[model samples]
Every structure is written in structure tokens, then in C-alpha cells.
Target: MFKLLKYADKYKFYAFLCPVLMIGEVVFELLIPQVMANIVETIRLTDTADAAVQSAAVNDIFLYGGKMLILALCSLFCGSLAARIGSIAGMGFGASLRLGLMEKIQTFSFSNIDRFSTASLITRMTTDVNTVQNTFLMLVRGFFRAPIMLITALVICIRKSPDIAKVFAVALPIIILFLAIFAPIAIKRFRAMLKKFDGFNASIQENFTNIRVVKAFVRTDYEKEKFKKSNDALTAAAIHAEKIMVLGEPALILLMYFTITAIVIIATKSIAEQTLDVGEFTAIFTYAFQILTSFLFTIMILVQVFMAEASAKRIGEVLYETPDIKDPENPEETVSDGSIEFKNVSFSYGKGSDVIKNVSFKINSGEMVGIMGATGSSKSSLVQLIPRLYDATSGEVLVGGKNVKDYSVYGLREAVSMVLQKNVLFSGTIADNLRWGDKNATDEELKNACEIADALSFVESFPDGFNTDLGQGGVNVSGGQKQRLCIARAILKKPKILILDDSTSAVDTATDARIRASLRRLAPNTTKIIIAQRISSVSDCDKIIILDGGSISDIGTHEELLSRSEIYRDIYEAQQKGCDDFDSVGGAS
Candidate 1:
């Protein structure tokens, strides 16, 4: 947690002021006991004395009472200011921490994000940051005030009467012992509780994201059961962690009461023996309470710190993480052409076996190519390399006759537009979503792109035309409309290479064919690579590539592949017979 304090550098002035003002409050509190002692002594001196003496004592009481009032108001003023400053610093630190984490997450590649679950990251950003923020507040407000009050009060008690101060010798050790015994167990339990929190958040996210599927399949009961299990586990873990704090609280409170009772008994004996005066005894009680209360408060703060330590560690892990992919020392600023080649490239998600193994292929500039393979053939993985989304494990992926890594990641991706099978749209107007491909695009450009993707017709059919709002995830639009809009968004980029990864599956064959034909007409100089299950979709391509077991089985025109490649022939024959299951013909790849 201390490591993250760099975020508070911007609020250093407020952080410094919090403890200083808290100490001012402690000073006023400490002085109040002395004023009370003075009032008690004056009363003792005047009891049963002459009227003049009693009158003087009353005056002294009034003077001392006024002083106490002023001191208390000063303390209140300082404390209120300190609290405000502490909150400013703590909340500011949290804001900076969250911003820093988000910025780091943005720089992360797909593989880097894979290392952490989305739910866990969300918990770290929210719950973990809040815990640490609260701890920061405690430290700034009480770090100096508690220790100074405790030590100063104890010293005053000892100097006035050593015997009475001995009561603390018994109390301090017990508090220390309690902290030692409960702290380690509490840390481990809190860590477990945070993990349970992650699971609970994950359950909520998955359930809500796929609520439509659950309702469609009538699996709400199963989802409810799953959610209940997560909720129960979170509750159990929270109780397990809090039980230690609960058990320790009353034990320490009881110890404090016993210690105070012992002090009263000892002070009464001293007064009877004429060694302690009434005023002095009264002062001892005040100082003793301060000492005990400060000590107890310190222990509570320590417990909070221990529990927050778990959250701190989780947050630190992401802040210190290094991305697996990084830009080169000097990278190419632009791609030269639409030409692409893969030279013995292989890739795996992590340390697992390569899903794409030593595969080699090439596509000429301005060529419309189709890639067909059975399920698990790593079709998406192969194209991801071209944009440097995931670096090839071995060999090189070249775009525009240069290694993809030679270009800046942003530069490379800007030139290659890929529409994944599960493309999504944000909650916005139709024009708002299309402008994502080119934010400065004109009204005419949007219509042109949408027309090329066969989306303009339906988009205009709406009452608002291109201004129609698509609900969250484009829920208001049909799946085919979403796909076409995504294609239109890609087309707006006017990228050198366009990849549609089974993106047309939601649209009918006629619509798909229209999209392909429009691409050939409007984007003649651009390289187009299409991945599809239907042979008819790729039958008109300039060349077709067949993938089997992560290796190239054949590369030729559609007619040549049907004659030369047995797998391609099988898939074609299966499709011609109205069969869509490629695995039944092409087998496992």
C-alpha cells in the first residue's frame, strides 16, 4: 500500500496538513485535563474557608472554565479542517490510482489482458482501490495524533505519580498481544474474501451479459442457483474474516475497563495516604483515559492496515505488470501496400502447444482471397498476426513487404481492418457508430460505406434514416444489420487489407454475395481475405487457401483447389449437396 503513495504526490500539501492539524487537536485535548485539575485544586483550597477565599475560588473556576471552552473550540476547528484535508488527499489518491490503472490496462495487448480475468480487474479497480483509499485516510488523520497523545499522556502520568502509571504496564502488552495473534490470521482471511468478491462479480457479469440466452433457453433457474452459490460463498468468506475483528473488539474493551478500574483503586489509596491530592488524582484519571484510548485506537488502525494490505497487493500486481508486446526502438510509420506473406509462422496463446504451426502462405496486393478450414484450424489466429495483435511465436508475418513488427502497432492496425465473427456496436446512433472508422467522415462517406456493405437500404428505411439509434450492443438491429454495420465501419477506414472472419454468417447468402461483389467493385485496390464455412461465399475469390491441422493443405484458385485438394473437394461436394457442416467432410484440422 505504501508503494502506491506516489499517486498522492499531487495532493502532498493536503496530506502533510492533515497530521499537523490533527496534532493541534491533540494538543488542545491534552491541555483540557490540566484545566480541569486547576479547577479541582481551587475548589479544594476554598472548601470551608472564609467567604473572601470562596469568592476568589469561584473567580478562578470561571477563568479556568472559559479557558477550557476556548481550547475545545480550537480543537474542534482544527479537527474539522484536518478531516477535510485528509478526505481530499485520500480521495484524490484513489482517483489518481484508478486513472493510472486504466491507462496501464489500455496499453495492454490482448495476451496481456488474458493474464487477468475481467471480473478480477474490475474488483481491483473498484473494491481494492477503495480499501486502500480508506487506509490512506486513517494514516493521514491519526498517524501522528494517536502516538503523540498516547506517549505524552503516559509521560505526564508517570511523572506525576509512577505507581498509578504502572497500570498501563499491564494493559499495553495485552493490546500488543491481541494484535499479534489476530493480525496474520486476519490478513489471510481478507485475502480469501477478496478472491470470493472476484467470483461474485464474475457471476453477476456473466449472468447479466448473457441474460437473453438464459431466458431463451429457459435456464434462469440454473443461473439463479449459480448466483446464489457465489453470493453464499462471498458471505461466508466475509464472516470468516470479520469474526476475528468482532471477537477481538470486546476482549480489548474489557481489558481497558479492567485497567481503568485498577487505576481508580490505586489512586484512592494514594489519596487516603495523603500522597495524592484531589486535583492531582482527578488529572491522573483524565490522562489515564487518554493513554488507554489512544493505545486502543492505534490497534484498531493497525487492524485496518492489515486488512487493506491484501487489496494493496492485488492492485500492485497490475500496476507493475509489463506488457508482453511492445513497440520497437524505431518502427515504420506506415504500410507500403496491401501485399502480405506469412513465413513459417507459428503461434500459441501462452506456453501451450502451437495452434498454428510452421504455416507458410502469401497473398498478392489487390487480391481477393478466401481461407477455408475445418473447426479449430486457427483461422482467426493466423490473421491476428498480420496486424500484430499477437506476435508469431516463430518466423515472421510481413505486411507490405516488411515484418509486421517493424511497424508501430497502431500504424499496422490502422491499415488492417478485421471484422470478427462476434462484432459489437455501442449504444449510439447509426451514424455515431459508423464514424468510429473515421471520426471526421462526412455524411456522404458514411452512406457510401454502408451502401458497399448492403446496410444503407435498411439504415435508411428507419424513420430517422442514418440517425436511428442502435440500443446497447446494437440490440435494436438484426444480427445481419449489425454485421453489415460493422463492415461499413471497417470500410470507412479505407484500410489497405480487409479481413471478414466469418462475419457474414448472420446474413443470408444473397446479402453475403452482394457484400462480396460490392467490396470487389468499391475496394478494387485493397486486399480482401474472407474466412467462411460456406464454399459458395469464397467460390468467386481470386484464390483460395485450405488449412488442415494448422498447416497449408493447398493454395490456388477455387476451381484448382476443387481439383487438386481432396479436403477442399470434400467440402465443396458437401456444400453442393446442401450440407453446411464442414467437419463432416473436411474432418478435424
Candidate 2:
């Protein structure tokens, strides 16, 4: 936890002022009891005296009372100031910690992100960070005030009567032992509680992200049950932790009451024997409360610390996580062209077996290449290598005659624009979402790119045209429309290499053909790589590669593959039969 404090270095002045001012508050508080003792002793001495003596006694009472009031006011002022400073320091630390965590997450490669679940990351950034911030505020204020106040009050009590102070020696150890034994149990429970929180968050996130599927399947009851299970687990864990923490309060209170009773009995005997004065006895009792109350405050602070300990560890994990992929010491600033080569490239998603094994391929600049594979054949994995999303496990992937590792990650990614199979779009107007590819693109550029993707006609048919809003995940658009918009967005990049990973699968055949034609006309020099399930999508490409079981089985033009490659021939025949069946059904209807 202390290691994370470096983020708060900029707020050192406020951090320091908080504790220093708290010490002032404690000093004033300690003086108040002493002043009250003086006032009590003066009154006792003046009892049954002459009128003048009584008058003098009244003046002494006023004097001591005034001193007590001043001390109290000073203490109040100092405490309020300390609280303000502590709040500033604590809030500033949280802001810094959040920024640091977010920046670290942004640097993570795909592999790094896969190591931590999205729900867990969200909990660490929000709930865990909040716990640490609240704990920091408590430490700056109560952590300092308790110990200093305890020591000062203890010293004064011992000075008044050593015998009575010995009672604390007995009570203090019992309190310490109780905390030592139970605090760990509570901390362990808190840790378990945080894990439950992660589960709960995961359940909610999954349900909401797939709400459409859930409702379509009429499985809302199942989702509710899943969420309830997670919610119940979290509640159970929190209750268990709170039960253990609550035990401390009652035990402390019992010990405090017992000690106070002992002190009162002992002080009565001393006063009767003339060994301790009435005024001195009163002050000892006041000091005893102060000391024990400080101890009670300390215990509460320790409880908060234990709660934050789990959060601190979670936050530290994110901050200290190293990205598996990093830029070189001196990286190339530019990719010369879109030419790409994979030399014996193999990759594993951390499993022992490679998903893409001993794969070797080459595509010259300006060539249209198509990748064909069955499900789980690692076709998408192959194209992802071009952008360096995940590094090859064993061999080199080269872009523009240079190893991908030699180029800066940002520069390499900027040069290769990919429309992923998922076709995600942020919540924004059509023009805004397209601008993600090139922020400075003009309205004409957006329209031109949309036209190239065969999206302009539909876009213009809407009353809002390019200004139409796309709700979250483009929920407002049809699947085919979403795919075209994503393609348009990618086209606006004017990248050196363009990859479409089943991006046109949702569109009709004629629309898909028009899109392919537009790409050839508008980006004749850009290297195009297309991955598709339909053989028609890739039959027109300059060359096609077939993957089977993580290895390339054949490579050739469409007609050459139909003659020699069994897999390509089989797929083409199957797609032709499906289209014929669809046409027959339409005619009969």
C-alpha cells in the first residue's frame, strides 16, 4: 500500500499539513482536562471561606473556564482545518491512482487484457480505488490524532496517580490481543467479499451485454437467477465480515467499563486516606476516558485498514502489470508498404499446442488475398498478426520487408486498417463514428467512403442522412448496415493494408460484389486481405489460401483451386447448392 503512495507525491504539502494540524488539535484537547482540574481544585479550597475568599474563588473559576473554552475553540478550528486538508490529499491521491491505472490499461496488449477479466478490471478501478481513498482520508486524520492523543493523555494520568494508571497496563494488552486474533479473520473475509463482488459484476455485465439474445430466447428468468446467485454470495460474504468486525466494539466497551469501575473504586480509597485529592481524582477519570477512547478510535482505524488491504493489493496488481508486447528501444516510424510475409509463424493462446502452426505466406503490395478456413481454423488469428495485436510465438512476421517488432506499435496499427468480424460501433452520429478512422475527415470524405462500402444509398434514405444516430453497439442499425458502416470507417483510414474478416457476410451477394468492386477502383494500390465463409466472397481474389488444422493446405487462384484443391471445390459446391435451394423455394412461394 505504501508503494502506491508515490502517485500522491504531488500532494505532499496537503498530506503533511493534515497530520501536523491534527497534532495541534490533540495538544489543545489534552490541555482542556488540566484546566478543568484547576477550576475544580480552586472551588474545593474556597468552600466555607469568607465573602472575599468566595469572590476570589469565582474569579478563579471564570479564569479556568475561559482557558478551557479557548482551548476547545482552538481544537475545533485545528480539527476542521485538518479535515479539509486531508480531504484534498485523499481525493487528489484517488485521481492520480485512477489516471495511472487507466494509462496502464491502455498500454496492455491483447494478451495482457486477456489475463484479467473486464469485470474484474472495472471493480479494481472503481470499487477498490474508492476503498483505498476513504482509508487514506481516515489515516491522515484519525490515524495521527488517536496515537498522539493516547500518549499525551496516558502521560498526564500517570503523572496524577501511578497506581491508577497501572489499570491501563492490564486493559491495553487485552485489547491488543483481541485485535491481533480477530483482525486477520475479518481481513480474510473482506478479501473473499471482494471476489464475490467481481462475480456479481461479471453476471450483470454479461446479462446486459447480451440482453437481446436473452429476451429473444425468453431466458430472462435464467438471467435473473444467475444475477441473484451472485448477489446472494456477495451479501453473505459482507455479512460474515461485518459480524467479525462488530465483535471488537462490544469487547472494547466491556473492558473500558471494567477499567473505569476499578479506577473509581481505587480513587475513592485514596481520597479517604488523604493520599489523592478530589480535584486530582476527577482529572484522572477524565484522562482515563480520553486514553481509552483514543484506543477505541485506533481499533476502528485498524478495521478500515484491513478492509482497504484487499483493495490495495488488487489496485497494485493492475499498476504493476507489464505488457507482454512492447515497442523496441528505437522503433521504425513508418511502414514502407503493405507487403507482408510470415516465416514459419506459430501462435498459441497460452496453451501448449499452437493455434496457427508453422504457417508461412507472402502477399505483395497491391495484391488481393483471400483466406478460407473452417470454424476454429485460426484464420482471424493469422490476419491479427499483421497489426501486431498478438506477437507470433516462435517465428517472425514481417511488414514491408522489416520485422513487425521493429516498427512502433502505433505506426504499425495505423498503417493496417482492419474491420473485425464483430463490427462494433460506438454510440454516436454516423459521421462521428466514421471519423474514428480519420478524425479530420471532411463530410465529402465520409460520404465517399460510405459510397465505396455501398452504404450511401441507405444512409441518405434516412431523414438524418449522415447525421443519423447509432445507438450503443449500433443497435439501431441492421446487421448488414452495421457491417457496411464499419467497412466505411476502415476505408476512411486510407490504410496501406485493409483487412475484412467476414465483414461482408451479412450483406447480400450483389451488395458484397459492389463493395469489392468499389475497393478495387478506389484503393487499387492498397493490399486487401479478405476472410469469408462463402466461397463466392473470395473467388474473384488474385490468390486464395486454404487453412486446415492451423496450417495452410493449398494456395492458388479460384479456378486453379477448383481444379486441384478438394476443400475449396467442396465448399464452392455446397454454397452453390444452398443458393439453388433458396431460389427454388422463392419460385414455389
Query: RMSD, each candidate, Å?
Result: 3.2, 2.1
| TM-score, per-candidate, Cα-based | 0.97, 0.97
Worst 10 residues of 1 by lDDT: 580-589
User: Which residue pairs collide in model 2, if any?
Assistant: none
Please write out the lDDT profile of model 2 over residues 204-309, one tens digit for every residue.
9889999999999999999999989999999999999889868866877888899999899889988999999888887888889999999888887888887898
How much is 315 displaced in model 2, in angstroms? 1.0
**Candidate 2 least-lDDT 10 residues:** 580-589
lDDT of 1: 0.91
List, residue by residue over 528-577, the lDDT tens digit for candidate 1.
99999888789999999898888888899988998899999998887777
- Which residue pairs show backbone clashes in model 1? none
Question: Once all C-alphas are superposed, what RMSD does model 2 give against the true structure?
Answer: 2.1
- Using alpha carbons, what is the TM-score of model 1? 0.97
- lDDT at 262, model 2: 89
